[model samples]
Target: MELQQMRYVVAVAETSNFTRAAEQCQVVQSALSHQIARLERELGAKLFERTSRRVRLTSAGEAFLPAARQALDAAERARAEVAAAAGEIRGRLAIGAIPTVVAVDLPAELKQFHLRHREVRISLRSGGSEELIERVQQGTLDVAFLGLPLGVRPKGVHGRELARGDLVAIVAPGHPLADREHVDLHQLSDEPFVDFPPRTAARAQTDEAFAAAGARREVAFEVTTVDFMARLIRQGLGVGMLPAAFVPDVPDLPVLRLRDAPARMEHLIWSRFPPSPAAAAFLSGLGISAA
Candidate 1:
């Protein structure tokens, strides 16, 4: 009913605990409970279902959550615009990144952005591209630098391609296949492959690479996390197919070229909303690409 009510709803939804949400709002739990009850009453719908152990959003809550968050975002963006007009930029920003970007390349860029925008506080979250995408859609992130090109969706966000890399075979340095200039998929068809789990966008690309090459890559193991796959590769359990940037040592395992495999493109993505002056200036300095 009120902006304050929506703010409280968002806080509760995020923390999933009345006590924690109250703490975040710096208010008493009783007041939060009372306000939330009032909000539900005004809406004539049950927003959340509470139990002794947990609080979960009802369907109504799920529908209302994004709208509420977007309303808050619009207000905040307006405030930021006003502040920028007065020559100041200050706000909290949540950013998301996938494993490859988080481990291989984003540190330097993030450091540079931070140094240049001392007033813009940034909170970074790391997950698989899928999780990052949902967060971006849910307004939990102001921006995200995530992906493996084909592994994302057309959402209400903007994206800029950062770089493209081949899906390189990752092996241990002493692996026998390291001597070759280009180890094609046929050479390692019998070798166990550590891979992204099936049904993922990256997996689709990886599958296409093997299918088009007519190479039957054996699934020695499948994992959701890049770290797990890397460890398996190091242990010689399997060879992983990963973006070139993710595996710095091609010689470790065999650096195989998947014939006609889709090039993985890492990108810098953000909500479509106008950025704060600090974000805008930093983006200009970084020169994020749309390709």
Candidate 2:
């Protein structure tokens, strides 16, 4: 019934381990467990089935989860609103971004925002475009930086395009195409490629571009991190295509301009609803109205 108890429950549900939840909540495991146990006693329902190996929510816990989240959200919003009325912006801002983000100097912006709003806490997570958008829409992320194929705007969220640029091919120094100033997709069709996993937004851009250009290429290495992809390219395992702006991150790789390449659009997206005061202030600083 208490907000603290609900918070413990929510944390436990999310982490699925009492120890981990306690760590996340910044409390001792015994205290968190005692609080949750007391809350369950008051409700006359067992909230979780705990074993040494795993912990899972019971039916009652599952049913109570949504209302608990709503209550916590409402309480946090009320607190933030009161703080804002007192001429202070105080809240947590969760931001998500793709690894290839280059449209905005994220670290610089975050440092500036922190200096301006010392009372606000900020956290950042990296994810794919779709996952970041979903987190924003779910209110878990206050804002997100997404990279999607050109002409593909984020659905069910408010987004402002920051920049658009074509992808460039990168090859090892000893590769045959490394000396070329520029090449078309068809010209590199024979080269094995290193790219993101299939079905991801990042991979779709390259896949669609190749299909449109009537070029068939093999993706011999599929990796998650850009660093790994860059390493593979450097070893001559496969050719990699990345945004021109991002090429600087993987230095020493020979970059070849692609005459026919997929264009990526970088965007800042947020929930459609009115943003928290902290988020609004941050957006306003960037000249974006988070209305």
Candidate 3:
């Protein structure tokens, strides 16, 4: 009926001696014996037989002992699980990321996180900043790596400033702008451009920064994926403004800083606590440069 009763039954079954089981359980012998007797009485069967020399299980005791052991074991396992879920060392983490981080930082950060907490499972999703912010607000994601300001103030979601840098204009090495130390918004005013969809972080930074400088855009393409955008740029289809951190492994695609453009914003966000131990561990683990 009670976990204590099951525990008493299990102890008696394990030691086969009231005195020994009581000593092991840090309880007095007669008190342990009385509790076990009470348990057997409640069950309508004697669970043990005792003589002057020793104690042993009754036929019912033999049958019930294994069940008692299993019950205690199950109770212990459940307690451990609940405790772990509360603040224990390991569990699953669902994180949302802006598309740029998936290409730039997530891999290394994830590697360090897993190195410290091998038992935790991690899931990552990539999307535009607003979509990721919405997922965090709707409880669909535990955390997000954001590259732009949430277009509007978002509720139920909070962010930590991760890194702040400018958007770099990327072009193939042989392109006319690649050799320039700095590229101005005016240089690309008539040249074709690859852009993030409207209202997205990438779009806002590119549009606002250049427009503020009185530079106009010649829209050549609109695409969301960083890699694909780079591919398009490599082909000279259009040049794109990407997070300053994105450097293509290919030597031919040079990313140039937009000295003439406004700065790009970056952040990491999460649903309000209760944050997982994993989340705290991750945020703490990030470099001071990123934090």
Candidate 4:
């Protein structure tokens, strides 16, 4: 099968929409569909089930997608390697970061890296730490900033510690614990809380701390982003825990250190597999040795 057809399959798998996949691949929808149909015929298995409402991968497509993605990545890496040999650092670098990563000055770092390597393309995605880590392991993200539990390291991913800091409690000025310098997990047991949803590293850290303290908090609001959590806390919806950097600087919003909370360590993680040349260069620019 042609490499371009493999790319089309991967794109359709990712988008789950033929038109969007075609747009992403910079090809016409009919052509992309024709190519995919040819590929399915060649393999004697339908890759996708198409309907008016949605396009979803068939069972065979699910089985084939991972290898297809790996082949695409391998081809891109080969091109990047040749570019590196020619003294050119040119390729796409997909990076992931959690919402609470403001403390790392990521924008400034990326600006500098881009200035130094203008030919490199950078794509940034924001998600929960666990999601970012999963993407890294899946080879979708070249590198990611993850807020892992203290002393906890995920398997099959190489990570370097970027920063370690306490998770602080944020509340409105009139909240009972607002004036406190530090609040223990148990103290907020009965309080209404705003927090990250399950499967997020920040949520995991908070859950572990509360469980260790034998406290069960009432989650009044569950948000996907730190900024939204801050806004909710500021509106007195509920108190929430986040990295200090993620807490807004409003005068009426108070940030108190968590007395018994374990520090969350921000790690720059990547897959154990070899990195693309662009990824390697970006990591090196960040003073990380990806090798």
Each model's C-alpha lDDT? 0.74, 0.92, 0.73, 0.86
Query: Model 1, 186-262: lDDT tens per residue?
Result: 78788888887776666777777778788787786878777788778888788777876665633345566655645
Residue-level error in angstroms, candidate 2, position 69: 3.0
Q: Kindly list the per-residue Cα lDDT of model 3 for residues 72-150, writing each as its tens digit.
A: 6456545546756776656556788877763236788788888878877888998888898888776557688877643
Q: Give candidate 2's whole-model lDDT.
A: 0.92
Ranking, lDDT, top scorer first:
2, 4, 1, 3
Which candidate tops lDDT?
2
Please identify model 4 stretches exceeding 4 Å from their true place: 248-252
Let me know the TM-score candidate 1 reaches against the reference structure: 0.81
Which stretches in model 2 have alpha-carbon errors above 4 Å?
Answer: none
Instruction: Indicate the worst ten consecutive residues by lDDT in candidate 1.
Output: 249-258
lDDT by residue (tens digit), candidate 2, 110-219: 99999999999899999888889889988889999988987898888998999999999999988987889989999999999999998788999999999999889999
Clashing pairs in 2: none
Residue pairs in clash, model 1: 171-252, 171-253, 172-252, 172-253, 173-252
Model 1 has a clash total of 5
Per-residue lDDT of candidate 4, residues 234-257 (tens digit) = 788898887766665444578888
Model 4 scores a TM of 0.90
